[model samples]
Target: MRRSPDLHLPQATRASAGNLPAFLAACAVAVPVLLAVSAGNIADPIVRYDDYPALLAQPEGFWQKTLTEGRWLNYLWHLRGVVTPAWLNFVLFQILWGVTAAAIAAAAIPPGNRKWFAAVLALTLLPAPPVFLMAPWSSTLIPGFAVLALFAGLALVLSQRALRLLLPVFTLLAFTAYTTFPLILLAVCLISTRQRSLPDLAGLLVLFGASFAGAVLAVYALNWQVHGVFGIPLDPARSPDPAQDLAELWSHLPLLQETLSVLLGKLSFQSTPVLLFHLGLLIAATAVLLRRQPLEALYLWTALWAGMALMTLQVLKLGVTIPVRAFHFTWILYAVLIVRAAQELSRSPGLPGRLARNAVLLVALSYLVQTAVQFTRFRDWQHETRAMAAAISAQPGPVYATGSILDHPAARKAGLHRASSLELLTGLQLSQCGAVPEACAHLPPRLSSPAPEPQPQARLERFEGANVLVFPPRQ
Candidate 1:
């Protein structure tokens, strides 16, 4: 039997409804102001990386084929035009992803528990964590949007009315339209829970399944359009053996940790108070879950285990040794756990238990303060991108980007030649390289056929004639 939301609640319980004014006020101020500042300084240097070059070069045709075909239909990106430095436009949108995290924390808790709601909101908005710093640059924007979709799903589940349930579905669809992974994971988690009804269960499964299928199709279509093959033709030059690749990633792990630690507030871990503060919160959150919120605890534990297991193979293959990208997803599961912890805290009637919970609040509050301080660094770091773009823009001759920027409109408009790397630019003609490669020397022999002679000095030589913009992210 389905339980109505209104009938299930305690009389004193409050939803986040009353706190709207404050939350909105914070979001309204923070999201725009930060974007505006970044726009004033940031430049859209979408010419350096894998997806960036392709997307910028053909945003519309790409997305159009994507929807009609099945993958990152570059059509929309092309239509959107090159995301330029318009202040608080797309550049700022990247920063705003954090708001979704806050909103999820907000929706995960019952509205009645105003304090926890505020805490979650504050925590997310507080600062950029080590996870955001020194890792894949996309963290500034991507996860926040994913989180917003998540909170919307949560809202539907908790809503007392039918209309409210529909809202989550709409939100989920929107998010699914944007990015499929988080919402897919969220749907999996939601439907697996015992509390949901058949309709709730069925809807999520269908949506996730269909979207996943669509994405796969889109990718195939993209391969077809770019390479004239239904599938991406294996390029021996680009593929690397997964096992050996794994070794390279392992060698880089220590550096990754050091970068993360710095984001956590340590030049060195030995005496950093910031390290102690976060470690303490982690302990507290763990203890509270183990002691009281066992179900939620189990969910979080499963999410971590599953996420780690799933990402491990990709990490090993892709050579993405760092855990920052994985952490972004894990954090949401943790946020859900925190909500459960807060729920348990509310249910405890004794003074000692209440006081212990209060201690948890104090610690959370402290973490929030630390987070805000660290987040300010993101605002500062935006300058580095602006500087890099300006340097390339000022350079003579056609600009060619090797990584994510090739897809961006700005680089394509600048008539940049696309290549997998500086070495490739020196060695191959644009027609020879094509949109996607026919032979990837970087890939493993099993995945592709090999044998492009090492262009020993080609990488250095390529930049001699053309301008190359390299951010050379910290390893």
Candidate 2:
């Protein structure tokens, strides 16, 4: 493999300013404060979405099921009545994992490119786009977690240390069942190639693989006990068929065009600079790749494909089907490739590496600044939503809002008892109780119902005639 020439370390005082360990430590400190502040603003008692609702409604049983059945293994097993507290805890841990992954990816960069790598990773984590504008926050958070797991696994595989060799296996098993297949392929590829030591790689492979396989067996056993089935069957409605999902993805081609136009179209001081910044980098990268090579060519191809896949989903009306944050893994990998290419070109005596590095830094920095600004804005808006939820909770009569079309679990998670769009509850009831909507009308108005041991103190009542009341949360 080709490598870069090392410039002598600067004086200790100068080196301190650019220290990787200190920089990462600072990042560690900053990320939690940022996450805490962000969470504080958005973590209202009101249900923002369904996952939270399920966790709050059924905590203990949920945790029990997740531990036994595996993540994504038992969700459909018990249906809505089953809560997955373990999954929530998994999510919280995954978020922390994401921070660690980002730090690792930043660290893997050459010392000189550390700042730019950090910038690129940050931008990937928090992009400003229509998806960010429209999707639920969990949408962002879930994929963000998945992406972290994916990249961390990659880093571990590449590092080839004994401890690191087993990293991908645990990460894949801990995150999701569906994602493990590709990751296994990655592990086997690295192991078989003798890219790293065989003993260490094979040992970790068996250890982690056995653990994952054992978890699967345990989940299968649980399913047999619960529903008399040895397999955890996919829900027909929710099962993923690549062809179908791809078609569903293609339907949003027009929206993709619009979003592209938005990103590349124009920028005002008030508008997000994300589009402009990325576009500039795209151009610069194109220029750098004018001469392709084994290393340079592969990096170019990977980056292109990643971008295309992301943009294709956006265009297909899927509206960012893949988490934008997750795309950072590809971004970081390609960034490494770019640095490598620059190193190769600069060593040839004619071209100035410093000038190229400075130029790349400028472009990368612009994108980084734009991404930070976008994250701050998102944080601000989410704060408003939390405030709104609290204000609504504080009111006497059931509060309504255009937000009522919210995913049911969000309400449940928020600890709100009021039903928005009785249709949702009605459907859920029908699914659970196998009762028809028409049958409800046949029942007496004063039908007796069991009362709760502890009555709910307040609820934002929702009904068909109610108007959704959405207001900015109090400052």
Top of the candidates by lDDT = 1
Q: Which stretches of candidate 2 lie over 4 Å from their true place?
A: 1-48, 54-98, 111-164, 177-328, 339-364, 372-475
Q: Model 1: per-residue lDDT, tens digit, 1-475? A: 9876667664223343443543454355445544443342244322223334333344532433333323342233345545443332345344445355444444445444555454544454333343333222331233334444455434424433432334344433343233324442452355225344557445644554565455455556655776566743323443433446547767645544543544334311235664575456556667887886555555556555554544554445443333343345544554455445655666757774565456555544554454334344434224434554455446554443332333333333333344343322232232222234443333333223212332211111124455533222112
Q: What is candidate 1's local distance difference test score?
A: 0.42
Give the backbone clash total of model 1. 71
Estimate TM-scores for all models: 0.52, 0.47
Q: CA shift at 294, candidate 1, in angstroms?
A: 2.9
Q: Each prediction's Cα lDDT score? A: 0.42, 0.40
Q: Please provide, for model 2 over 227-278, each residue's C-alpha lDDT reduced to its tens digit, 9 standing for 90 to 100.
A: 6778545434332233347666666565656554544432322445744554
